[model samples]
Target chain A: MGKDGEVDFSIIGLENEIEQIQSNIDDLENGKGGSIAIIAEQFAGKTTLINKVCSMNKNRVEMISLSSVVKDEKKLQEIEEQKQIKIIDNCHFLYRHKIGGFDIIERFLKTVTSPENKQYITTWNIHSWNFLENTHEISKYFPVQIKLQGLTQEQARQLILSEYEEGEIQFIEDPTENKEKMINFVIDNTIFLNKEIGIPHLKINYRQIKSKLSRKKIILTPEENIFENIYSISKGNPGISKAIWEQSLVYPQIKPGDIKEPCQDMELDNDESFILSILVSMQNASRSDIIEIAGDEIDIERALQVLSKKNIISSEREHYTIKPEILKCATNFLRRSRLV
Target chain B: MTMVGEESGSLSGMPSIDTGTLLSVISLLIIAYVVTRVISFLLTAFSEKVGKYRIKIKMLLPILKFSIYGYTVYYIMAKLLEVSAQELILFGGLLGAAIGFGLKDLFADLIGGIIIVFEKPYQIGDKIRVGDQYGEVNDIGIRATTITTPDDNYVSIPNYVIFTQSVSSANIGNSEMMVVTDIFLEHGSDMKIARKLLKEAVVTSRFVYMSEKHPITILTKDFPFYIRLRAKAYTRDLRYEFNFESDVSSRAWKELKKKGIKPPGANLIDSSSMPDQRDR
Candidate 1:
């Protein structure tokens, strides 16, 4: 009721992009023949930048996303007719095996960006430069190129702060204590900026914070405290962070001010204790390797299945690896738990 | 020829040879050699013919061929020369140590090959991961195992390595394996919404299989600024993981964004959570 829809700001960074994208829009509005492409690595903010341009020119320009329309040329033509600014999001998917030919791309580009159509086009990819050779061959048809790189530290910091605020996430830090630490804390943990909704995305949140603190109360289970302590230490990577948090959260709820000594006070269920042992062993394994090793054991498989379902771990073929932030958080918890 | 005759005479304990005796011996020697060659060829041809019907039998062609030749030579000595079969057999035993030392690895591989045939650690068309290498078993041999990888490269590993090294067989000796994909959402996003979107994504996807074990589920936990949201679903076939993952990820992203759920903040967490050297 209080604008409290989880202050999830999906927009962040791209300050420099906002201006260039606006210019692109202006050029398109004037019926410019040139096309622009934004490219980056996977998860490197390519689509976000292109989307920002489309959003900036929303009313003045019509945009179409051509990612999923692989086998259907008609759908693409239809979208082009409906939209003024044609943007293709998953351009890679179109070229992958039997989907389409370069002729389609060439035809689409020529039709959309022709002077007669008075339209503009933008394409997004993780690596725009990789398309340089191909685009050069197609230059006689469509010839605009733009490459996106990683964010600057300041931009990254701003990006992170925005995501946190948008999420309505509260940091327990007192500003007067050390401003540098606060900024560095957010900057170091933040991977990138959000483009659609502006906000810094933190690596961890309040529920995780609560779970880390509630490892006490289960009188019969003490080992759960290790999981709780580890979750707190992990700082929220989905994989290890949840592993520790879930293990600890299963314990009886405990207040934040309950007491200091986690090792001496906490209790855990047998299953929680068993999970902690594997989690502890998992500290030394990559997510993929863990999946490989644990594939045979029902309990380990169950744990990994749960972990992967939680997005704590990812698998490619026989290999599995925990997400980066989750790894960070889980290890931190382990270190802290060990210290305790 | 004189020296050969002298050696043969000493071995045979004959004093001297007349022209008729020498001619007869030479003809007999020529006949024995010809007979052995013809028999060897016939045996090898039969081995090849048998090999076509059975893989295990095919792998034994070299051994079977050698054994046939060895026994044939012994037969020529015993039957042609009128020498005792026991003497030929004894001579083979005396040469055993020499052959063994020279062919230790070969012998080991051969034995390992036999083990492979009987133990059946892998067979043709089984997906297997051995050490750092993963591929489908193309053919199993007595001394080596041939595998073709997903990249289309064929690798031949020694049968002995298979016996000694750790091997991981996926799909539990079956052709099908569960392929899963993960979907991430912005922190504080409606978990129910995300879950529903993911379930829809999986259910709507052509590749996704709806089974009791593979039911899609969404999980939530704190991940930095965003509550790390994940939707996981399984594919009955492992080969579709690549396509399924891309499809689900893109769909889930579109759904989450359309629902107005932003991604997590970019801010870093407290430095205390940064990995220590010990974490690795």
Candidate 2:
């Protein structure tokens, strides 16, 4: 986690996105442009970037981080009067997902587009940004839109290891000669004398094949393979990669095979899917907010229970959020369903 | 022309077929069938896995099936039976005449299926209407195109209908399809709020898919009895067309009623015809 005073490069591998944002800020400081919207997936470091921007600009910008839905539309109007630039995080909370949920967002859009001397910087979930882009052409209002990309293997390594001292952690290798074999001995049941028998079935591991093929380009040392596997599973997402790394770590030693893939499922009803989409857009939605948005047609408990059973989301103190490791899979599933 | 100088083993200008050749033909046909079934299963599984490329991947099914069967037939005639070019043409002509006389409808349907595959009128997963049947096209078979009606009824319309009747596809080959939702309000209702609520209802619907290319549009027109508010938006998937419309309409109506935007009273407009042109 980055501090408010000094921002770290926790959002590694997003130099391009940071550069684009910095260029936009430069243009704003010169009085040459409009507002900017930082669009990214949850836990992709939107908040860290905002802090970095605030600390870099010192007194020129004021930050407003919305922890929950904004019921008062007028509260947004009363920004720091001395600051010319305002950075609002979780801008997706500006509106709800119900019938009359768009009033506050509409007012905000109008205020931003009405030729005020001030410029605003906002951070939004990619899915929420997409919904607004389609409905209100939100992109037109924010002249600069920067989407944060995922971290690379090197960047993920740096981000994950930034906290630990050199040689404090041990990178252990696999005991077997064949670490990432493309072929594996998978178990299967075969009928023997009218009874089922378990036997070792020779199965081809396609993922191992891909990993092996990818090794030809960048071969890592004994310890680097752990980060590579974590990167492969997490897809270089900083939060997910770090989470997987910590879970796989045993005190000072960590093994490559310790990093396993997340569990999979094939069920999501319409209501469950809608709830997941809402949670993704909001990043942190209370149970009541979910029920209110889903309305009467949905059995909110069943949906929430199903999501919990699948380990796709976790709730604490009535607020639900997607698991960091499951974020990519959940997003992909939602995208396939067109819910996000 | 003359049985290839009598060395190709022809009987009455027809290719000679022995027991071995017949077995080979059967084996070839079995292999082709297995190949097509496996390919179909894999492609369908993959298409389900990736929704964005569902149509593009499924569109390859008919073509792949045809290629496999076409090659199987060609191999059986040209290599297994060792039929000459001239003899093959003569046999094809005879078969064509027999089909023309006895199975005209079947042949027409076959040709229509071929046209559907190549001409790109509509493919699998498209929302189409043929004659009076409207639904999401589930499968495009050799003889007919099967669609699951909004009522969830699987209706198989003959492919030949593409030639005889006017066929319309709401979404040509894309997953996002435009759905028209209408909301009627009293003459003295809050028009601006109704429009705003309708737009919000559409944009906020979980089933809706919006982008710069597929925009949500709301239009209003004053009718004799009341003003009709129509919302034109694209559903994420054509299969969710009705659900999207219902989602938008119900939510918009709920908000409209709360805001005192009363629906036009019963019997104010003609029950039989409410100017469907009020759509669009």
True contacts kept of each: 0.00, 0.86
Candidate 2 residues A1-340, lDDT tens each?
A: 2457554656567667667777888888788888999998888888888877777777788888898888797667667778888889889999898888888998888878876567899999998898887777799999888888888888888888888989999988877873657776767655599898988778676667887667477766767888878887788778888888888899799887777667453457778988999998899999888988999889999899978977899999999999988888788888888888
TM per prediction:
0.30, 0.86
Residue A158 shift from truth in candidate 2, angstroms: 2.2
Candidate 1 CAPRI assessment class: incorrect
lDDT by residue for model 1 over A153-254, one digit each (tens)?
Answer: 333334434423343432232234421221122322211453334334443344435554666545322223333334344432223333333343323432
For candidate 2, the TM-score is: 0.86
Model 1 lDDT per residue over B222-278, tens place: 655555545555543444555667766666677678888766554544346533311
Measured by TM-score, the strongest candidate is 2
Runs of candidate 2 with Cα error greater than 4 angstroms are A1-32, A56-58, A74-80, A114-117, A177-207, A215-219, A263-267, B1-38, B79-93, B276-279
Per-residue lDDT over B161-229 for candidate 2, one digit per residue giving the tens place of the 0 to 100 score = 999899998988888889899888889887878888888888888888877788878989898898988
The total number of steric clashes, by the backbone 3 Å criterion, in model 1 comes to 52
